[model samples]
Target: MAYQVTLQPSGHQFSVQPGQTVLEAALHAGYALPYGCRNGACGACKGKVLSGRVDYGATQEGALSAAEREQGYALFCSARPLTDLVLEVHEVTAVQEIPVKTLPCRVERLERLCHDVMGIWLKLPSSERLQFLPGQYIDFLLKDGRRRSLSLANAPEEDALLELHMRYVPGGFFSEHVFNVMKVKDILRIRGPLGSFYLRESDKPAVFVAGGTGFAPIKAILTHAFNQGLKRELVLYWGARAVRDLYMPQLPERWAREHANFRFVPVIQSPLPEESWSGRTGHVHEAVLADYSDLSGVQAYVCGAPAMVAAARRDFVARGLPADEFYSDSFEFQGGPGT
Candidate 1:
């Protein structure tokens, strides 16, 4: 049996199968709902259930608190509606059209962006072409049927190489192999182009908030913007613990110098005394809020740690930034063998 699901405000309607989650049904019906970490670890898929009972399957307690559940909030990615439902969710129209694909790729190169961050490039088979949006991600299929997710750091261009920024997690099976054992020419299976985070084509000014290596997708989006000759004002706020963590600092600086509409702000949460640091300091999102008090006309792309992404979404929306205009991808590492 299928249950009718209606979205509030927009009044868009879709049908959900008995076993499918709200998000799956919405996506299947061509409605792109805001989401990240579809596994229910991140709260990015949270939405208000207006008038239906839903069974939230295996959701982490921290992802949605008891108080939130009592208030009719549910994670669309994990919630299965029991009856016809009315929901309130922010839909992203721009990214709704990106297609998804699964393909095999060979490792072409591995460049160390930092001590712990590696820029892994994969070359698609000559017979295949990977069609994906700039800020989407692909999941690496493991031998045991498990998967590890990583965002693309390069835009879809004529070049058939897909770039990924992988952060090394000590004791992680995949990270250890990637840093110590993985080599060029290795064939890896991937299923992807998932997630709703992407550049929304708009004339409004853009604020890009990146934490740690979350800069990967943002980099792809920025490059795409530059290639397309987007004239909208852009400010990139990249945050890291130290100067060394801000990998590819030169790229943003060079981009800002070349594009009159672009500005780069590298923020450090902690700086060594000998580093002679002089720039924005403290939290990266706070820096944006301090500089641009009125976000009523700005669009923000936030990608990074779950904490940072969640905080920015709440604070920025409260400060007049339209909730629909704020797109984000929260990187959540499942502490497993191949995470």
Candidate 2:
């Protein structure tokens, strides 16, 4: 049996089929809901059920605490509708209309940006170019049925070759294969561009915080903004462990030099003496907080480790950043229930 689900405020409705999660139904109906690690780990798709019943499927307890459940919040990615339901959740309209596709691509180049970060450029078929927002990601379909997710580092306007930045996790199978075995002309299948994190249309100034390889999507967003001739002020704070971790530092520096509306700040967490690093120190989000005492008038986009993303969201919203104005995608190595 299928049940109808209605979104509060917008009143957008879709049908949830038997065994299908609310998220699956929403996606099938072309309604974009905020989600990450669709596996119920990230808590990005949490929403309140205003009516009817749902089978709250498997979810990490930390992600959806019993207290949160008592408060009427459900993880849409893992919640299966038992009856007609009304839910309260913000919809992402930017990518709702964009078609997601599974396509074959060939590895065109692999440029190692640092000891642990590799820049992957995939060449798609000549007849088709992907249509995606700046901050969306693509999942590489692997032979063993395992999928590797990587954010598109290049903006949509620069779609000749899809760019991705991948961090080398020492014992990770796919990552190790990419660094050691993957080659030019290697054929790969990918489904993209997924995720709700993107550069939204806003008149407010933008603040971007990126940690480690999380700079990929932010780079795309900023580049697209510049290409579109946006006059809004944009400041990026990139956090890294050391100078070596600051891959492509010159690119953001160049951007700052060329664009009067853009500014780049590099924050090194643990700078080594021999690296000759001198910059803002500590967490990327904290750096932003230090600069802007009141973030009431800005749109903040952050991508990084789970801790950083969570801390930033909590602190930023607490410091006057409208809870709705903050956009984020927390990097989960083992992404949960990815769409």
For lDDT, the strongest prediction is 2
Weakest ten-residue segment in model 1 by summed lDDT: 330-339
| Model 2 CA lDDT for position 178 | 89
Cα lDDT tens digits, model 1, 251-298, are: 999999899999999999988776779898999999999998799999
How close to the true structure is residue 18 of candidate 2, measured as C-alpha lDDT?
88
Model 2 reaches what TM-score against the true structure?
0.92
TM-score for each candidate, following the candidate numbering? 0.90, 0.92
- Candidate 2 lDDT over residue span 1-339, tens digit each: 989999988999998888899999999899999986677665678889999888899887756778889988999999999889999988988797888999999999999999888899999999989999999999999988988888999999999999999888766788778899999999999999899999778889999999998899999999999899999999999999888999999999999999999999999998887877657888788899899999999998888876677678778887999877888787764334221
lDDT of each: 0.86, 0.87
